[model samples]
Target: MSWHLFVVFFASTFFISATPGPNMLLAFQYGLNYGVKRTLWTLAGLSLGLFILLLSTLLGLDVISRQSPWLLTVIKTIGALYLIYLGISSWRDTNNSSLMSDASAMSAEVSAELTPNPDRSAKPLPRSLSSAAVKSVPNDWILFRTGMWVSLSNPKAILFFAAFFPKFINFSAPLWPQYIMLTVGLFLSETIWQLIYTIGGKKLAGWLDVGERLAWLNRGCGVIFILIAAALIVDVISTL
Candidate 1:
């Protein structure tokens, strides 16, 4: 592929990746709950899942769709159901503790430690005890798996890749090298936007630290997930 073509492809993908989707929503939600350092695992998982979809499309998803269309429908149905499960899980997760509360607790603990206390014999509460109200953080593996499954829960992405990539591909050129270049370009775009969403979520969490705003934000994400799942189901029914 020529430089001009690659540039165009990159531009198109950058805009496409910027669109808010399930993957971005996950990154945002995880970033708000877990912070940026841990959210890296989720981002990695998202990349892997997206890579698999792209690879499957390039390898033979088009042929599979033509040969076994029902299989695609089955995949979509399962994906939609999984999304509904995630949506309900998010909706039901009504943890009252916000990151701001945790920070405030820690700050208070530090202040107490710094203050001259007459009761030297009385020890300060342990860090865990002080922040006991905060929910336990999920292990890294759980975050990664959540990201992967969320990404994979939209099999329409495979169909999207199958349709979208061909417009940028050159049939006359050596295919694998072009694929590699395109993949790298697309990933670069995705990574940038994912980071943007994560950081944006973190900042939003900070602002919404008052009362139940953060909790509502999470429920809002849950509602979006269900909406996307419903749209997917509708599309599947239409195809039938």
Candidate 2:
């Protein structure tokens, strides 16, 4: 690729990845809860998922676009439903703060009952089901599956690949080199922005010291995700 083309690709990729989306939100949540390390893990998983999606598209899996409209419609419907489910689930999860409070209160009561000396201060136990855990280290399979599904199933992603990825290629030039350039540009942009998001999230985590505060933050993030998911659903439906 020429230097001018490379710069265009870089600029486009950077701007697009830096924009807030489900991937970035999840990465930020990962950073806020599990710290930067696992966010990186999550980002790595995301990269792998995107790479596979791109490769499949390059291999003409998208030829199904000509073969069957119903199949594509089903895929879009599934994606839309998934986004709606994520939104509703996140919105409903805001009530988790009460659960945390109850757990804390129960722990205090248990500690008080167990202690013979009333003068001794009772220590609170760590919550088993923490917002940080749910937001950050999702169940292993779920994390991987989410990465794959979010990247592959989203109609927006398919539209993006269809409209954007092909624009950069020179059909006469060697195919391998163009693929390599696109892959490098795409993954590098994704990784760099995700790292920035993870670092910012860690910094935010520092402010959320108390369990109640963290719980509130988690709810707030959940709500934000829900809103984003709702928008995604709308976008999908409009396209359909």
Candidate 3:
């Protein structure tokens, strides 16, 4: 690929990656929950998923998929279930800071009411701040798996890759070199744009710290996941 062609590929990928698709939305959520550093694990998983999706497309995964209808159903089912699992996880999660804030507010209210009646007999324990930290944290593996689940579960992603990749590929020329170039160009562009989105998410999260409803955010993300899964399932049904 020439420099101009490379530039075009990068620019095209930038727009594609920059668009607020499911992956970007999840990444934005990761940024809010884990910040940029931890969000990289999710990004890494997504990048790996993308590589697989693109490679499969180039190798004609679509053709095989077309031949076997059951395969498509199986994939859709798995993806939908995985998304539901993620949604449930998100729905149940609560921010530690939010918990701490509530605890503090309750403590103040209790203290005000009990000042005169000094309850020396029995006093409840204030929550340990250390425990709050633990409740807020998640391991890297969970984040990585969440990213992969989103990428792999979307049966449409492979189709998108199949459709998107061939526009620039030259069959007359050696294929591997073009594939390599596309891989590098797309990954670089994707990483840059994903990082930008994540940073923006983190900043927005900072602004929302005072009034953020983390539970609602999680539920919203979860609902979106299920909706995407439903859409993919619908597509599968229509194709059949």
Candidate 4:
């Protein structure tokens, strides 16, 4: 791909990635519950899942879908169900007093421990509080898997990549090098936006640390997940 073409592709993808989607929502939610450091695992999983979708598309996912339409339907059904499960889980956590108490206790502990240190800053305590609140935050592997499954659940992504990549690719020339360049450019854009969402969520969590506000925010995200799942179900029914 020429520099001019690559630039155009990058620009297009940057804007597309900026749109809020399941992957970004996961990152944001995780960032609110965990910290940015823990959210990195989720980001990595999201990238790997996206890479798999893009690779599958390049390797003839379109042909596979045409030959076995039922497979896509199966995937959509499973994806929607998984999204609903996540939504319900989030809703359940909305009134989790233990989590809030743990976070508040940890915040007090950190403050007490740091009280004697004249140079210690208060900025890091919020991050510590967020992570501490969820005493049983899933391990790194679970977080990674959650992100991967969430990304992969949307079978439409394969169709999207199948349609979107061809516009930027030059089939005649050597393809592997172009694929590498394009992948890097796309990942750069995705990573930047993922971090932005994560940080934004963390900031919001800090700002909404007051009573009930954070719980309501969690509920709102749950609603968004279910809405997206409902849309997916509707699309699947329409396709059939």
Report per-prediction Cα RMSD to one decimal.
11.8, 12.3, 13.6, 11.3
RMSD of model 4, in Å? 11.3
Q: After superposition, how far is residue 165 of candidate 4 from its true place, in Å?
A: 0.9
Q: Which tens-of-lDDT digit does each residue in 1-240 have in candidate 1? A: 888979977876675565446777667655655678887998998899999888887667345455776876675666677667766876776676665444445333432443334333433433533344224455667657667776787887875565456545555467778889889999999999899878785565466666776566556656655665676687678778
TM-score against truth, every candidate: 0.56, 0.52, 0.54, 0.56
The global Cα lDDT (0 to 1) of model 1 is 0.67
Give the TM-score (vs. native) of candidate 4: 0.56
* Poorly placed runs, candidate 1 (over 4 Å): 61-134, 202-240
lDDT of 2 by residue, 187-222 (tens): 888888778766774454344444555445444544
- Local error of candidate 2 at 22, Å? 1.1
Query: Worst 10-residue stretch by lDDT in candidate 4?
Result: 114-123
Question: By the lDDT metric, which is better: model 2 or model 3?
Answer: 3
The C-alpha lDDT values of all candidates are 0.67, 0.54, 0.61, 0.66
Tens digits of per-residue lDDT, candidate 4, 1-240, equal: 999979977876675565446777677666766678987998898899998887776656344455776775665666677667756866676553433244345334433442334332212334446444444455677668767776787897875555456545555577678888888998899999899878885454445556776566566656655665676677678778
The segments of candidate 2 whose C-alpha lies over 4 angstroms from its true place after superposition are: 61-142, 202-240
- Candidate numbers, best lDDT first, in rank order: 1, 4, 3, 2
lDDT at 225, model 4: 54
